[model samples]
Target: MSNVVAAAENSYLAAFDQPGRATVEPTPRPGWRQAARDRFAELGFPTKRDEDWRFTNVGPVARTEYELAVAPAAVTLDQLEPWIYPEMARAVFVDGHFVAGLSDLDGLPDGVRVGSLAAALEGGDVTAHDHLGRYAPFDRQAFIALNTALFADGAFVAVPAKTVVERPIQLLFVAGPGERRMAFPRNLIVAGEAAQVTLVESYVGLGTESLTCPVTELAADPAAVVDHYRLQQERTDATHIALQHYHCERAANVSTHSLSFGGGLVRNDVWAVLDGEGVECTLNGLYLTRGRQHVDNHMWVEHVKPNCNSYELYKGILEEQSRAVFNGLIHVHPEAQKTDAKQTNRNLLLSSDAGVHTNPQLVIHADDVRCTHGSTVGQLDADAVFYLRSRGIGEEAAKSLLIYAFARDIVDRIRLESVRTDLEEFLFSRLPKGEIVRQAV
Candidate 1:
């Protein structure tokens, strides 16, 4: 084994040995923790040799020795007020532990359960035991394994059958005052038959340098509708790795939107399986990177039944020596018929040193399937810039306008008004001379 791999293995073993690092009770799935650890030990971390991980390396994560974040830190709502949405129900976690004082769940609808995973388990919520680690299989992925083995706390959301939740549920995770530390967060969401719900998962970091690994599993029953949004806006010096697994049953509708704006090294893995007929799935993402940052997004969609539809669109903006990677795969099984799938990736580079790698693949074993994919990587249109400049717009402002226009395509698709407005404000602030545009708004 390589030295980096060995060092990583040692760190994992040491962390596992620490007291109270793993939270597993005897009543609820006793052997799962051990099974996950064994799986991680067998598979180890992914290297550059792996085709799926060829562009992104895990050496930095593996070699770094980070202590577990266990202590509870004080964080007021004022510190998080800017990011909080007043229209949504909130559940907060700080440094891997749920903080009741910082959370608000007033006026929540009936037939819905929202709280911390640890509390749910202790309260004997059977649904948590039934679907905690089912969708996100840990055997094939090392990061998932690590999360399963060491997860301290996360969010749990369940919508009962035939219920409609009009308001969105927000899961906020904050990392505060811990340097060289790591936290594992796991979430499970289940939408029953004919149920409708929306979820927003946000990760914010206030610490200097830390690492966060989070895994979320979503299951939608027949005729159910589930909308999920993940927003990652951590400290520029922090590292983030996240995984999401979605299962759509017959005639179910599921949509996921991911917006990534901050982090030093970030990787996101999303997988969806359409297991029943007439299902609809939508995946959309936008990522912005600058100042030597690295972001990677990997997605896979599997069509297991007939008459299913899937659509994917991902956009990226890179500047100032930043780098990004996008890898997407659409697979149609032999038994599946009339599967309609479309995938597209578009990227904009602002600086000469900025770089992007995009790959979209389609594998079809069914004769009656329509699958298409495309990818593009380029700089801004000089003609458009010139046209704006000729109209008395400053050069920098012209570039900013073009960049915002390029991003507006993805932003307009967001259904939630509050989320859309927040993202617009955040994106505008990151642009060059963006304060001028903000003033006009």
Candidate 2:
């Protein structure tokens, strides 16, 4: 076996070798972890030769040997104040383990439950047992297999039938000051029949050199409406790989938004399945990169029944020597007649050294389906920049204003006002002479 395999396997055994660690935080499921462990041993890691990973390389991740944190890192509430929203329920995870002390769920309405996934399993909650490993199978991806086998804790949320949550629930994962350790965060969200809720999965860490792999699975029952967001705000030196799996039942309406700002090497995988007729699914994303950062997004939407609808739009902004990739597919099954699916990917490059690879595809087995996909890559419009410059704006500020105008198309789609407002401020602070842009808003 390669060093990567040997090092990762040793960490796994070490987790079990420590007395009380296993008993303190048992696997989410008993047999599933072993199954995933076996899979990881067999598949190891994916190379660039793999079709899905043709342009993205994991060699840096594979070659490095990272230690796992033995306990939760000490994190203060003051350190978490920036990410927490007022009057919103939140589940907090520090150093890959859920911390009830840092989380708040006091005002959650009836039929809504939120807590640690490990706690739910230890308590023998039937819902957690029935749905934990049902959607995100680890057979295809080694990182996913690693997460399944080693994730000690994460968030668990359940909203029962016909219930409507007034505010979005936050699943915040923070990495505190510690050794350069690896972290796996696993989350599960289940919405019952006709229930409505919004979920935000935020990953934030600063000045830490580590590898973090997270997996989130969402199950939307028939006629359910769920708005979900996956936000990545890691340090520029961190490595982050994340996966999202969504399953929608008949007449269910689901929307997902992805916002990425940091990380040295990042990969995001999103797979959504419309399992019943009359389902509506929408996916939107925006990513920003500078310096030597690398970001990749892989998206797949499957239409299994007739009369289902899905739309996807992803936009990216790259500067300096940054690189990115967007690979998306819309699949219409044979029985999915009258399916309507649309996909689009757009990118703006701010420097000559920056580049991107975009591929949007449609595979239709049904002749009656309506499926379309397109992708584009370009630089900031010279004339538009000139127009702004002629209006007394500095050269740098003019460029920043135009970039903000281009990115807001995706940010404006967010339904949560708090998140949208915060993101706007973050952008302004990052831009050159951003005060001018903020006033323009």
Candidate 3:
């Protein structure tokens, strides 16, 4: 084992021994638990040298030890309303354990199962071993391995065949204040054949200091349709690392959105696999950062079969001395014919000190595939800003309008009105208003 592995093991052992960490009483399971622990021991965390992780570094994270997240600490609705979306089925996880009292899953449709991974595993309602940790590259990420070995609570959703769930299900993972919280917030969303549903997973942190490590896996069967959204809003002193993988079968449709607004250092790793013909996939994201924060998004979309289509668009705004990175790739395998894929990444720099790196890459092995990727990093359009100012719009308002317009394309693509509205409101709150532009003019 390498020094990195040794360090991770030491951290894990220390975390397990700490009384401050929440006691994870995963329902009594002998075989599955042992298997998972073995798998974790065999695989350690990944570093920047790894090919897929070359763009991001985990050195700072590796040195620090984090306990799994715990339940919210007496926070009122007014304190959390900004993080919660209205009218959605809510599932709450605090300190890495599901909080039944705070979660509301009363009106779910028939045949749809929603609960903690531990509860589901204990109840024998779902096979924890069948799909858990099955898709992620365990060898590459030490954090992933740690999560696999230690994840005590998670969310599981099952939609029956051809069933259409009109309402969206919300999963909220909260890491309360002063907690060395580490949570493997796993989400297994299996959409049965021809089934349709929408889900939103929101990660929030209370208090000043917290940590969240989350992994989610989503699978869609043939002809199924699913929409997934990941929203991250935590305290400024918080740290977060999340990995999401999506598998789409023949003729299936999968759409995912990532919205990030908080954390000291944040990394989001996403991979989408088109495993069958006629599959359609879309990946969209928006991230805004200020202060000394760092946000990284690395994504991959693979077309493994013929006649598939995928689109990716990510936009970001960086303020103050913050930094942001976007890396997206689309791969068309040799067997994939008639594939249509497009990727674009755009960034707006709000401060001269801010740093933004955007890369959109494409690899095609098939002859008859249409694929394109491009990335651009630039400042707001001066002409547009001037036009707005000439219209009697305050300088701050002018800049705000231009910035908002710059991000409108990605926001407008959200098919769900409720989610779209929620996102818009969040964006409005974070963006600079008419004042900043006027000062500049």
Best by TM-score: 1
Best by lDDT: 1
The CA-based lDDT of model 2 is what? 0.86
Residues 1-441, candidate 2: write the lDDT tens digits.
567456645555455344534232334556777778788877767778789899999877776667666567888889888888866788998877889898888877887889888888789777777888788899988888888877877889999999998878999988767656777888889999999999988888843787889888899999999999888888888899888999999999999999998788999999999999999999999999999999999999999999999999999999999999999999999999999999999999989999999999888899998898999999989999899889898899999998899898888899898889888998898788779889988
Candidate 1 yields a Cα-based lDDT of 0.88
Better of 1 and 2 by lDDT: 1
Pairs that collide, model 2: none
Candidate 2 weakest lDDT stretch, 10 residues: 18-27
lDDT (tens digit, per residue) of candidate 3 on 136-243 = 755556666566656767888888899998889888888765656566676677888999999998888875657677878888989999999888888778888888
Give the root-mean-square deviation of each candidate in angstroms: 1.8, 2.2, 3.6
Off by over 4 Å in 2: 1-30
lDDT of each: 0.88, 0.86, 0.78
* Candidate 1 local lDDT, 31-105, one digit each (tens): 887888888887788899989888888788888888887665788898888678878999988877788888888
Collision count for each candidate, in order: 0, 0, 22
